[model samples]
Target: MGRNTRKRRSPLATKVIAGAAALAVGGGGLVWANFYASAHESGPSHNRTRSAGAQVATIQCPDVGQKLRKVPRGARAGVDRELAQLDKQITEAYARLASTRQAQSGDASYVQNAILGPLKSKRTAALDRIGTNIRRVGGNTPQGLGRFAECRGMGVDQPDDGNGNAGNGQDGQNGDGQGEDDGQGQNGGQGQDGGQNQGDNGNGAAGPFAEDFVDINDVQPGSRDLENGFAANGEGGSQGSFTAVCGVNENNLFNSDNLIVAPGVDNGAHHTHDYVGNQDNDAFSSDEDLANAETSCQNQGDRSTYYWPVLRLQDGTQEFDAGDLGGGAEGNVGKILKASEAEIKFVGNQRSDVVAMPKFLRIITGDAKAFTNGVANANSSFSCTGFEDRQVTDKYVLCPEGSQVVRTSNFQSCWDGQNIDSANHRDHVAFVQQDGSCPNGFQAIPQLQVRLVYDVPAPTVENGQVQNPYAVDGFPEQLHKPITDHNDFINVMDENLMNEVVDCINSGEDCQ
Candidate 1:
């Protein structure tokens, strides 16, 4: 996150925005998931949206971790803890902002004076501690940490969504909540309801708004040039793939802690994760503990931990974690949706032969904070079972009667040879260049790809309300935007097994 992230445009998706009509169905409402104010604003500022009664959407703070270039090994743990606290602070601030919508609509200075100001004070202290932690460990403190203390309110002028909050101006539509022509014409009366029933606590804690979903048919087909350079190479290349038969989280190993990014912090993720592979993983799971834990993989040698935010059907079913912090308590209410199949596999890079990855190499694909942090790191893909050719990165795919929902996460396959992990947890590894070659000084490693298939009942939009929708658990501030969906992995394969997997790829053998 500290490093300069390269922007690479691929043939992954034709367009990331929802087709207008795709969101107007049954007055299902619109989701301004990408409409937040800039995070680069110096301090708290009014958005001056379409109306003076504009409401706050989500909190936007400079991502402190993403700005960090490095933290000495001795200071990494403390710095990580501080970074997690920063995220925690944002989550709490956003929750407060969400709950106080009525107040936000009335007083213009309310958010700046109350929410943003207090949040800044708290973040300032945390950033100071991070600097102290670095200096205490004989590491130079990174500059500009203090400048990130200020955050701003991100929102749009919103119609009073009958979802609960009041004083938010008024509904834009007239009669029937049906058809009414305007700037974009009828829109069938469906429009941004300023995020549906955000505080409902039935389907979700905050969101997964009606507009967050789109008809799979509405998405344009995305294309990818699937050249792996194996055939083009005259000399050598790793063309084969390896599969890890790690079942989905059938064991219900769930938690809201992120061991890689937020070690030692409980509920650091602020959302639940469905874990497979390592049986013992939580805020306190040390590398040693993970190494000794039983695994769900068929080949016991693959003890690596694989996890992602748990998908939940907003069916009002009370799950075990209904009262827990990372679960329903934090607005992630719903029936937990277990993936029917979790296809965990490692595939080779395209341009060159791959080298064995260091044991315990951690890679985080996609971005859990992509909702507010922007889509620079977002790579989550969604498609229906049969319509795999058509995928969308922002909208949840609604399948037909018999078709199932599918999620695909492709991890970075390039590694910086030296570090097993980096301060940012991402800088040590990178996605391949647009031409299928690793960046200079980076080597190819087995890229992990996970396909999670779910047999979820199609969520329907009826009379402006979406029913039984499924959304990945996420920070309340993120509003369950599909772009925030992500996957995490830590390489724990035994040295012998790692060597064997490398051999399988280099020898052009796709083996289990």
Candidate 2:
């Protein structure tokens, strides 16, 4: 790659050339001197052209006795070699990023899962630079040469989010501090070793998986993952790992958009994540899976939202119920509380006090001898409704990410608590408290409402047809994929049409 300097022909050089020509007309010794001087000052006009061709052909001389220098082919090759190595490096970095994502998101530990997507997106962006550079590498323009030179030594630095190489931390900070069950270090999690392990329920669907978030935009039409499974394996793709597929090729298999379930999907024949085959009467079957399937077909629908009927229980008897507040009811500790308009008003009024520990309440708790921050074991008691005088003598509760007091009734509340006992429960629990007692000490039994998040992919579209077989039963056959229909052509056509109409009007003709 070479730079083309579009140097303007100087007026001084033009003047000198004209003057030399005039002197040459006199046919004296001054003719040669003026001619030499003018040539020296102006150099070669052909070499100074604005085009790239002229630049490669230009010969530059340093001084009166110096030899004319030409660009060496070896130098150019050396630059090409450097760029090639950078290209290779970028590709490998992208691969590692993709693999890391596969390992992290696929039912791995919580810490590993958070970093994968950001890392993948970063590497993808870096790889995108290679495409732009590659195109410039083919040109002889100045920018093209500069870009090639810039890429001569480009490489990816494994991203570090301030956390040391110990790995597995959101913000690269220390993890939730809940160490592994096997007593492994930070990096020694279940989904490690390039995502080979399965059966680890880090925080995803119950199945073997890869470590990448599948973008719904990338799912291909008539793909199997969406059409067959319950919400594209929950992590957003088949086993949470995305296989790279050509966007336009008919045979390309990595179509993420194809993972979306269409509207009105039937669950009886839908595919499940278990490759070993479904057992125990569709253990994976659920209503949310069916609803997510239906969302795919309708453009206005959301793929993630799901609806289901509420079951009510009262006095050891179970029955069907309406919705929450908006005709809904919630089950707490084997009792179904109807969420009527009056009950909704009552709950809403108490929410500000019940949700998360109020600042004033926290100050009171902080001063208590029983309450300590990050301390493993200390038991006193924070004042609450039920356990006002009850002393929790031996339990240690760890305040995790969502540490807040939720007031339910005048005598009931909920909070996140970690049972410090190594034998009973090590993980944080969304405990609910009732009758003035929080779960651990002052909290009720049905503490926090736990909502498991899953990434449900969107439907795919090809040849103007929507592709979301996940919304239906049976595996869908692959369809033709065309990614660039709107941006490249539709936009251009819109502008063209506008211009044509404007032209016709200007020409005094009726615009079509």
Q: Which candidate leads in TM-score? A: 1
Model 2: per-residue Cα lDDT over 1-512, one tens digit each: 01111222234333211221111121111111100000011121111111110000000110110111222322333333333333223223322322233332333343223332333344345434434443454632223222222111100111122222222211222221133211223222223233221211110111001111122223233332111011111221111111111111111111101011111121211111111000111213233342333221122221221111111111222211111110111111012222121010001111112222211010000000011011121211211122222211111111123231111111112334322111111122222222222345332111111111111122232221222211100011000001000000000112333334334322334322
Model 1 residue 412 CA deviation (Å) reads 0.5
Name the weakest run of 10 consecutive residues (lDDT summed) in model 2: 481-490
Give stretches of model 2 more than 4 Å off: 1-88, 96-185, 189-490, 494-496, 500-512
Candidate 2's TM-score reads 0.16
| Per-model RMSD to reference | 11.6, 34.2
lDDT of 1 by residue, 237-265 (tens): 67787999989876777778888889888
Off by over 4 Å in 1: 1-54, 156-205, 223-236
RMSD value for candidate 1: 11.6
What's the TM-score of every candidate structure?
A: 0.80, 0.16
